[model samples]
Target: MNHGIEKKARIVGLFLFIGIVTGIFSIAPAIDSTNYLTEVNTNSNQVITAAIFQFTMSLIYLGIAILLYPIVKRYSQSLSIGFLSFRVIAVSLSIVGTILMLSILTLSENYVDVSSNNLLEIETLGNILKSSRDYANHVFMILALCTGNVMLYLVFIKSNLIPKWISFWGITGAVLSIVASGLVLFREIDIITVEYMVLNAPTAILELVLGIWLMLKGFDKRILKADEYENPDSCTLGTIHNG
Candidate 1:
């Protein structure tokens, strides 16, 4: 283990999470208007600020993935690489959503400011962009976030590199996230529903603890060495069972 990178990974993971929370909530009250045209006309500055925050959050995610990859690869090389890919997809989707959001701003400036009712087609296009933004966000959170976490936590568990409790909590959260996303996708339940929050809260808390644990404790040398073997799983499971 590169002690330097380990320390950096934990710190980066912590800030990466903070940035995500801050970036998303920064514009919530000021710019998150339901009426898109009204939002564009009245709070354009806030809307732009919100988009910037979102873009920054996506960038932070990239950093998190890169920082964690080295640590995770020792556990499962394939999953470590897959983690990067999943996060890349998630980040790309987030950027796409940001683009759609800015496009709505463009629509408002070009058409809504001029004539809202005369051209039903323009209104339709704006609505489509808005819908696309929402869907992109959904896919990012559902497919990318859940899948990535599942992969990470499973490797952590298998390698015995982190506390089993943390890994289990994270795995539970990943499972719930999958279920919550399925509910939203199929049932069309609102994303803001209690169900989603309930599912996400555990993972959110787990991440905070994980960051702290990694910073203070780092990965166990014994487990890290244990993972050098091709069949770390059998050894890890046997230890757990004997314990």
Candidate 2:
């Protein structure tokens, strides 16, 4: 519940996520011996490794979320906004996104063995992954809009939990996510498409910034106090006698 501790955890989680993204985009690209599919195949092991690392960092982020939600909810004095409300939505969508991403990774991993393995199975799995990715991205962007930007922003702009600029960035990030995912879905770029790849870093960077900010500074004190009251144990009931 301490803002200081929450900030530290956020920073740690952010740095971990940064490391994972860097490993996937930067380090992974350099490892490929061939430049043809260099973007796709280079340092694949590193990319997979990065995915695993990101997954681990997500778990840490989840922990931070768990600790901070009650504080924000209680302090804010309103369940309409803050950590708990936003997180309930954010986490649900994040789970969907994570699952889709994992499916995509698994299918891509097996694609290399198509000739030696079952071609039909590979194709089927690829379709499933692509569909999941498209759908998940759509839902994820929506979640950002509902939870990160709309709900959290109400608290930030009003409560001063975080700077206005940070809230602005969160809103911007939400919009960008929707747009990027739109380009991928409507334009059919979710699977190795150039448009999706082009928009990837910008969308990711925005989310990175937003995520870092949230981890560093949580919701208002009013929300945190409210959370305590909602716990039931914190409440004291007066004894009554039938007169």
By lDDT, who's the top model here?
Answer: 1
- Listed in order, each prediction's TM-score against the native is 0.82, 0.56
lDDT (C-alpha) at residue 213 in model 2: 58
**lDDT (C-alpha) at residue 87 in model 1:** 83
The sequence of per-residue lDDT tens digits that candidate 1 reaches over residues 1-243 is 334545665676576467648555534332235666665857778778888888888887778787777667766899888878888888898888888888888787776546546567777887788767767776455579779878887888887877798889888987877777777667656566677778767766777777677767776667555544655665456456435
Residue 191, model 2, lDDT: 34
Winning model by TM-score: 1
Off by over 4 Å in 2: 1-44, 75-89, 92-118, 137-146, 188-243
How displaced is residue 29 in candidate 1, in Å? 5.3
Worst 10 residues of 1 by lDDT: 24-33
TM-score of candidate 2 on Cα atoms, chains taken together: 0.56
